[model samples]
Target: MKKFDILALGELNVDLLLNRIAGFPEVGKEIFAQDMTLTLGSSTAIFAANAATLGARVSFVGMIGKDSFGEVVRSTLEQRHVDTSNLIEVDNAATGLTAILNYDNDRANVTYPGAMSLMGVKDIRPEIIREAKHVHVSSIFLQETLHKEIFEIVRMVKDCGATLSMDVQFDPEEKWEFDYRKILPLVDVFMPNEQELMAITRKATVEEAVDVILPYANVTVVKMGTRGSLVISGGKRFHMPAMLNKSVVDAIGAGDSFDAGFISAYVRGKDLAECQRLGNLAGAVNTTAAGGTGAFSSIEAVKEAAQRYFGQTIEL
Candidate 1:
């Protein structure tokens, strides 16, 4: 048996979220925010934490700087029980940070890559990959400089007999342009949101997008917020409706939680339908709080939500 159940690789950051007023600022004009809060982000970190909370032995592999933000990132991971021994601390670079602007249930973000850009394939140890049941990669853009090295790392993990999962994060800055078709075959599971699937495949419909990408992986999950998610594999598709909730406070990290939920259910050899339900429950519950990792529900809490909202069983 593998020593770890899952290993997440990619960027880590501190998010400074500002809630802007309802109206947009005019060109060359300034607008003030009503309130704000600082939170932990970085997609990989959030997912790894959620996975650990859901009962997976997980490790985080990424780079941070020797700064206060880096300390917060490490502290947050430690609090969530995620293994951070593999997290590299860069002496010269500053930790990654982001400023998020939120308004009327919508949000925009401005990010500074910082030390996250410095992570390379050499940072990954072969022995670590050999000890994991599953490996996940996130935030492809921030580590564009190390794409070739990342590909090599992914190949090595697969060669070592671990299942590979990938989460795609689109960067408007186009710091890196990913060829999904080229990378998909190397991954056992390809997870992306509806918009991301469309953008990557250049397809007009979700079904079309799935058809184009399905050949690349054994399983593909496209997360559609509110409406739920679509899971497809071997020419079969399952649509899981979103779990209805009363109120939503913050939507950050919901997708990462979904990834954790799905992988948790999946590693246990549950049916695809049940996995989607668990994933949906995890995502819906995450919106009820602030911050990414902070919002994730416990395994029992998620099971209760699934039973209460969807009248479904979350198979262990």
Candidate 2:
């Protein structure tokens, strides 16, 4: 058996969340935030942690700095039951960080890419890829080297005979430069939220975006918050409504939580429809808590929240 069920690749950071902000910030002005929280951040890390919590054997392969922030990132992953043996530490740059100004349902973020931007194709070893049944790559734009070398990385993962999943999170520069044709063919599962999909595909709507990539993509799951998710596979389309959480703490990391739930179920050989259901359930559970991983403390915790909040039973 492979040593790990999933290997999360690319990007690692810490999130400094400022909740209940007075208003959006302006030049030469500062606003007050009622509450603050510093927690593990980055889309990939959230996926790894929550997948592990769902009982998947998850490991992380990313870059961090030799600093306190990196310590927090490492220790937190360990505490969440994710393997960290592949984390690379660099003394030249600090660990990555994002300052989030959180409002009611959404937030604005400013990130310092830091060491995460330094990891490239050379840092990833083929043997390491072979150790996992699947590999997940996220936040390509957040890491400069990873973005430049993504094609190479995806080919390597396929060569290692591991299934690949990708979540192309928001582009900080807003210039979505990914060539979905070249990359999606190598990716077994492609996960992107609605806005991100439109941005990357330059399509007017979610349907248009899916059409542009359907020829190359294997399975594409589009995350539409509260409205639910859309799944496309084998030229078939299915839409699943969200398990609405009326009282939301925050929407931070909800997409990553969905990815975690979907992938965890995927490696266990669940059907695509079931994977989408678990993903929707996990995403709803995410809003019930403060951070991306807060609601997924354990498998039991996730199942409990799934039943209590959404009135749906989750096998994981």
Candidate 3:
């Protein structure tokens, strides 16, 4: 029996947020931040937490060090009702962390990859793959081992009779070395932001990028922040407009939240149009709070935020 509706095979990290900085850092200069908040970080974690809040049976499979940061990652996921039984704790490295310097409407991030970069295809067990109805992986470039064995990882998950989704987040090195022809055909849903899509396809525009991948893509969803999203499958296309919020906060995990909403609806057999709309709504809601999981505290809170902020009722 499948114990989980979704298995988020992604990175686990902590966020060290620094707000109201004196000024941008210079090579030889020093500046101090006025505030600090250390919490759970990583797009996959946000997606899993929000999916759990949306009433999905979610579990996380990732590697972390047997340290305090790892403890933080485990406890926080459990608090979000995400099963962490599949988490792997390695003693060779520490948990990953991203130090975020929050500015007015933008931020600078420096990530310490740590154990998050260590998860490999060999680390994922077949029994755990059979426990989930679907699998979602994000931040391809960040995970060194996984990136090296991408095809094998996807093949393993697919062979287990579970569907697969992947959000190939920005390639930090700008190499954009992913082979779309091989990867796209295996992925049930291919999620990416506008920039990532363009980069991966080596195209200058979104249309150009879509044209290149259309041949191999099964279900492609392009997340255009503040501009909504695009849904493409077979020969049909849906352009989802953004649900703008009046009082906007930082957009830390908006895209991940969008993935959560989209996948949550998708797993429940919702049509692509509804999934795209819910994805847009969830992304909008994410910007109304401090961080990715803040606006998605619980199912009740999510419904309240949707009703009160965007005036939409969450079907879940």
Candidate 4:
């Protein structure tokens, strides 16, 4: 049997969130915030943690520095039950971090791409890829080396006979220089938010973008905030409504949580529809907590939150 059900291969970082700020800062001035929080960050880490909570045997394969932030990343993943044996630690660079300034419904972020940008194809091991039945890759743009070598990484997974899912998180550069036609065929599932999909495909609408990628994409899921998620596979399409959360603490890692739910169900042979439902439910649960992983401490916690907030029962 495979050692892990899912292997998360992507960026790892810490988030320093400053909330309730007085106002936007001017060029030479400093502003103070009323609240602050330091926590593990990165969409891939969120996915791996939540999937492990959902009862998937998850392992993480990412690069971090031999620093305090790296310890935070490793310990947090361990606390969440994700295997960290594959973590690459290097002394040359410091761990990456993001400073987020939150204001009401929106937020601004500045990131330091440290060691995460240094990991590339040379770091990935075929034996590690072969140990997982499925592999998940996210936040391509944030990692410079991984962004340039994504095709090689995906091909490696496929060559290991492992199914792969990719979440092309927002490209900070906005260049969106992805070769979708060549890459999508290797990706079993393509997960991207609506805006990301539109931006990547250079299409004005989600429909147009979907059309552009449908031919090459095997299974594509478009996450539309509040509205719902759109799924397209084998020439069929369906829209799954969001499990609306009226009192949202934050939407920090909702998309990653959705990915965790969907992929967790997927590796267990759940149908597409069920996977979508779990994704929506997991996303809703994410909003009920403070950060991306606050609500997902355990499977029972997720189940309780799902039932209490959405009145839905989650099997996983």
Lowest summed-lDDT stretch of 10 residues in model 2? 100-109
lDDT of 2 by residue, 1-316 (tens): 9999999997999999898988888899988899998899888998899999989999999999999999999999999999999999999999999998878767788899999999999999999999999999999998999999999999999999999999999898999999998999999999999999999999999989999999999999999998999999999999999999999987878999999989999999999999999999889999999778889888888888888988988775
Clashes of each: 0, 0, 0, 0
The digit string of per-residue lDDT tens for model 1 on 197-248 reads 8777878888888888877767899999889998887878888888866677
101 Cα displacement, candidate 1 (Å)? 3.7
* Per-candidate alpha-carbon RMSD to the true structure: 2.7, 1.9, 1.3, 1.3
lDDT of 4 by residue, 83-126 (tens): 99999999999999999998988989999989999999989999
lDDT: the better of candidates 1 and 2: 2
lDDT of each: 0.81, 0.93, 0.93, 0.94
**Lowest-lDDT window of 10 residues in candidate 1?**
171-180
Task: Give the lDDT ranking, best first.
Answer: 4, 3, 2, 1
Error of 2 at 257 (Å): 0.8
The reply for model 2, stretches above 4 Å from the true place, is: 19-35, 102-108
Candidate 3: worst 10 consecutive residues by lDDT? 243-252
The model with the greatest lDDT is 4
> lDDT at 76 for candidate 1?
85
* lDDT per residue (tens digit) for residues 247-308 in model 3: 88778789999999999999988999998989999999899888899999878888888889
Q: What's the lDDT of the predicted structure labeled candidate 2?
A: 0.93
TM-score of each: 0.89, 0.94, 0.97, 0.97
